[model samples]
Target: MHQFISVTFSLLVITGLRVSVQAGETRPERSISRHYISELTVTNGGRWGSWGHKEMCPTGTYAAGFSLKVDSAPYAQTNDITALNGIRLHCIDNYRRSLNQYHEYSTVRSEVGSWGRWTDIKWCPSGFLRGFALLVEKPQNTGDNKAANNIAFVCSGGAVLIGSGTNWGEYGAWSKTCEGKGICGIKTRIEEPQGSGDDTALNDVTMFCCS
Candidate 1:
C-alpha cells in the first residue's frame, strides 16, 4: 500500500531555479497529460481505487517546491525547460492515494492585497510520507464560489517541484498566477525568479504526461 509513481506534465511553467529529482528513480522520465491519477490517495493509507484522475498542470501556472531541472531527462513538452532531475518521494512515500493527510494551510504569509507577500514559509505534511496539501483557491468576492486558504505546495496527485525559497523568498514568480474564477485559483502552479541563489536551494519535482 506504499508504492508510489507520479509524473504528470504538459509543461507551461518557469519560476526560480534548481529542479532536481532522480536519485533512485521512483519513475520520472517524464510523461503524463491529464487524467486525474487513479484519484491520488496513496502515501500510507492507500486508495488509488478508481484509477482515473490525471489533470497534471493544464490550467496554467505550475510550480511546487523545488524543480530547477537538473536531470528530468529533457523537460518533455508544453514550454520545454529540460535539464530534468525530479524524484524525492519521501513525504510519507509521496502519493498517499488520498483520504486524510493534508490540512495545514497558512505558512508563507504576507497579505494586504496587491499580489505579494510570504514570510517565514512553512508546510509540513511529510510526517513520514503521505502527501496531499496543495490547495489554495483565491478570487473571493463573496459569491465567486469562495476559495482562498491553502498553500504549502504538496502535490502527489503527481509531479511539480521547483524551489529557491520558502514560497517565493529567494526568488519565485516569473509566471503562473491562477487569479480566480471557476477553478477559483489556488494551484502551487509555481513559477519563480525574483532573487536567485541559496535559500536552501532544492528541487525534487516529478511529472511527465503530455503525449
Candidate 2:
C-alpha cells in the first residue's frame, strides 16, 4: 500500500510541473526589438479603478482597428451601470493594406471588466491608428454613473473611426499623435464591481505607439 501511495504522489508532482510549464507557455513573451515610441493619454478618464497590464501587438505589427465591450443599455439602466467595459486592438502586419485585403492578423487587449459584450471590430480604411479621444461622464453624487462611454480613433490616413459604445460622457481632447509608426499597445484602468455601491467599469486608457 505504501509503495502504491508513493507512486501516486510522484505522478501528481510530475503532472503539476507539466501543467505549470504549459501555463507559462500560453503567455507570449515580449520581444526586446519592439519598443514603444510614445504613450498617448487623455485627461477626462474616470477617477476609479486600477490600471491593468499593458498588452502589445506582436513584432512587425501595428494597430489598424479596434473594438469595444459595452454593457447593454437596458441592463445598465436597471442594475449598477458600467458602460464601457473593455477595448481591444486589432493588429495588422501592413498598415498600408486595405481593410478587406488582410487575411492574417492578431488581436490584443489588457484587462477587461466583468460586464458588457464585445462589439464588432472597426477598421481603418488605410494607415495605422495615430491619435485617440475618449468620452467620459462626470461623477454623479447620487445618480447612476457611467464613466467611460465611447472612444474615437484618428488614423494616419486622416480617417476617424468611432466605437459603438454607450453615449454617456463628453469627449475629451485628442491625445498626442503617435511619434512612431502607430499605436501598438494598450493599457486600461478598470474598477471592479462594487457589491452594493456605484460601479464604473472602465475609467481610463493609455495607448502605446511603436516604431
Candidate 3:
C-alpha cells in the first residue's frame, strides 16, 4: 500500500497535478494565476508658460488612470490668460493595469479659436494592455481656458482605440468600465470652442495592462 501511494504521488507531480488531502480525501490543488505592473514612462508637449511638470510611475507598478486641475478652475471671476496647472497620476498594483499616456497643449490662435493636436497614444508590449481611464479638464466656461471634458475607449484584438465625447466646456468624469478584450494601449483627443482666444488642452491620460 505504501509503495502504491508513493508511485501515485510521483505521477501527480510529474503531470503538473499535485494532490491535496482534505477530509480524508484527495483532490488536485487548483492553480492561481496573477498579474502585475512592470514599468512606466511619461512625456509632454513643449509649450510655453509652465503647463505642469512631467511625472512617472514607480518602478514595477502601473498607472491606474489620470486627473487634472485647470489654472482658472472653471468659474473664476478672473481667469488666467495662460498658465500651467497641476496634474496627477493614479497608480495601482496587479489588480488594475491600463494605458493612454498622452498630453496636449495649445495657445490662443487668434479669434478663430484655441486648437491643439491629440498627443500620440502609448501602447503596451504586444498583448499586455487591458483597459483605461481619462481625466478631462472640463471648465465651466469656454472663453479663456479650455480642457478635454469627455473621452471613450475600446479594447479589441488588433489594438485599443479612443475618441472624445460631445461636451467640450465641462470636465465630465472618469470612464465607468475598464474591461477590454486585450487592451494594449490608449488614444486621446482635444477640442476648442468655435470662437477666438482660448488655449485648451488634453493634459494627461492613464493606462492599464496585464502581466
Candidate 4:
C-alpha cells in the first residue's frame, strides 16, 4: 500500500485575497493577492511527502506554460532516482500573443526536491492551461522508487503540452477542467531526502484556477 502525509491549512479568502491563518495567531500571517475560484487534482498521485505552500500567479496573470525539474536518465541511473522533482507555472498577463512570442512573463513553483535540473519551458499554443495529468510510479517494495515521473497539461484551446520528464510511470487520468479563466496557482507534495532509505521526490500536485 502507498504511504503519504496530508497537510491541512486554514485559509481565509476575502475580497479577492487569500490569507493564511495558522492555529495560534489572531491576525493573518501571509496573504496571496490573486484569487482562485477552484482547484484541480488527480487520483493517481504516488503516496509520499507533505504538501507544500501554495504558490500563485500574479494578480492579473494566469498560467500559460510550465517547466519541470527532472533528474535525467544517466544521472538517475547512477544515483538514487527522484525522477520528477518540481513543477513550475509560467504566467503571463496577455493570452492573445502568439505562442512563440512571450517577451515578458513570470514563473512560480512550490517546494521542490533537491536533485534535478529544470527543463526548458513548454508553452500552450493558443490559450491558458486548464487541466493536467500526472505520470506516477507505484511503490516499489524495497526497490528504488521515483514517485512522479512526468506531467501533461490541457490548454484552453484543446491542445496538450507534455513535459520532458523521465519515462518511468503511466500517465493518470486528466484532472477536471478549470471553472474560470485558467489555472493560476500550484501546490506540490514533495518527499524530503531520506538518508539511507529509498527516496521518492515529487509525489503529488494540485492546480488552482482563477476567474
Candidate 5:
C-alpha cells in the first residue's frame, strides 16, 4: 500500500523578487499547496514477478526524492533470486517549478515479499536529479528465484547502477525528464541482513550534476 501527504506554504515576493519589510509595504503573497503519494506492490519470490506500479507526485508537485528496497547478496544467503521490496517518493510543490523524477515498475507479482523502511531525502547542490526512465527484468526460475530480477533508474546522463540480480527480464527504454527549472537529488534505501539465512539487496542511486 502507498501513503501520501500534502503540505502548503506561502512565499512573499515583489516584482519577481523577495522583498523585506523595509523594502516596501507588506503585500499579499500567493498561497500554494501540494500532495505527495507513496505507492508499492506486494513482493515476489523470484525473478519472474510483475513490475510494480509507478507513483507520481501531485499535479503541482515534482519528485524531489526517492527510495527503494531490494533483495540481494548476503541477505539472500540461500542464493535465492530477488526482486523489488519497496518504493517511495518525495515531491515538491511549485506551480512553475520543473519535474524532478520519472519512474516505472513491473506490473506482475509471483509471490509475496517483505518491505524495508524508507530512506532519508537526498538533494543536489543546485538542481534536482532529473529522471529519464526505468529498466525492469525477470530472471529464469532457478536457484530460489522466480520473480522480477532487478530495476534500474535511467537518469539524464545514464542508467543508475543498482547492482546485480537475475538477468532475464525486460528493459524499459529511456525517456526525457519533466519540464521545469531546478536541481535534483537522489534518495536511497537498503535492507541489511537481520538474522541467519536472510536476503540482502542494495538500493543505491546516483545524483544529477548541477551545472
Candidate 6:
C-alpha cells in the first residue's frame, strides 16, 4: 500500500496536476509589471466616493486609472460642474511614490445614457496630480472647456509621466477617431470625443504619493 501511494504522488507531480514541495528560502517580491484600474460605475451625487476607491491599487510604478458610467442624456448636452461630478483618484502608498507619476491621461468620448459611452483623454491637470477632490456637480465651461461634465476620476498629470517612460506604454485619450471595437469601442485615440453612454473607458494615471 505504501509503495502504491508513493507512485501515485509521483505521477501527480509529473503530470502537473498537483504537488507540494518543501519550503525554500524566501526571496524578495518584485512588483508586477502592469495593472489596470477597473469596474467603474458612477453617480454625480456621491460624496468623496471617488477618493474612497483608490484603496485597490497595488503598489508599484503603475499608470493612474479611473472610469465612470453615467446617464447619457444628461451628459450629452451635459449640465452642472463640480468636483463631485466625478470621483477623485488618489494614492495610499505615498512613501516612495511621488505626486509626479500621473501622466498620459486619455479616454474615448461617448455619451449614451445606457450602452454606448465616451472617454475624454486630455491633460487632466496643469499642476502635479497627487490627490484629487470630488464634489457633486459637473465642471462648467469657465470660458475654457466646451462640453458637459461627464463623470470621471480626474488625474493630475498624465502627460509628463508618459514622456518620462522608456518603454512604450498604453493610455486612454480623447479620440475623434478611435480604432473602435475594443473595450466597448473604447481604445487609444488622439481626441476624446464626448457623445453619450457607458463604455469601457480608461485613464492612464501615474502612481504618486499625495501631498
Task: Report the number of clashing residue pairs per model.
Answer: 70, 2, 14, 0, 31, 47
lDDT of 5: 0.32
Q: Write the per-residue lDDT of candidate 1 for residues 146-176, one digit (tens) a residue.
A: 1112222333232333222222111111122
RMSD of candidate 5 to true structure, Å: 15.5
| Per-residue C-alpha lDDT of model 5 across residues 100-130, encoded as one tens digit per residue | 2222211111122463332233322223335
Give me the runs in candidate 1 sitting further than 4 Å from their true place.
1-22, 35-65, 70-162, 165-211
The TM-scores of all predictions, comma-separated, are 0.20, 0.82, 0.29, 0.82, 0.39, 0.24
Reference-based lDDT, each prediction: 0.21, 0.77, 0.30, 0.77, 0.32, 0.24
Candidate 6 runs further than 4 Å off: 1-55, 62-67, 74-116, 123-128, 137-211
For each candidate in turn, give its C-alpha RMSD to the true structure in angstroms.
18.3, 17.6, 21.3, 11.9, 15.5, 21.3
Error of 4 at 17 (Å): 33
What's the lDDT for residue 80 in model 3? 36
Candidates 2 and 4 compared: the better one by lDDT is 2
Worst 10 residues of 3 by lDDT: 104-113
Clashes of 6: 47
Return the lDDT, model 1, position 104.
Answer: 15
Candidate 3's C-alpha lDDT? 0.30
lDDT tens string, model 3, 1-211? 2453343335432221111112122121211122423212223221222222223333343332322333332432244332222232333333333332212111111011122222222222222334433424434444554344333332232233322222333223323333432322222223333244455544444333333
Backbone clashes in model 3: 14
> Over 4 Å off in model 5, which ranges?
1-55, 95-130, 133-138, 146-172, 179-211
lDDT tens digits, residues 1-211, model 2?
2453343335432221011111212233333345788899999999999999888889888888788889866655476778899998777777434544444556788888888887776777778889998989999988888899988888887667777788776788889999888999999999998878888999999999998
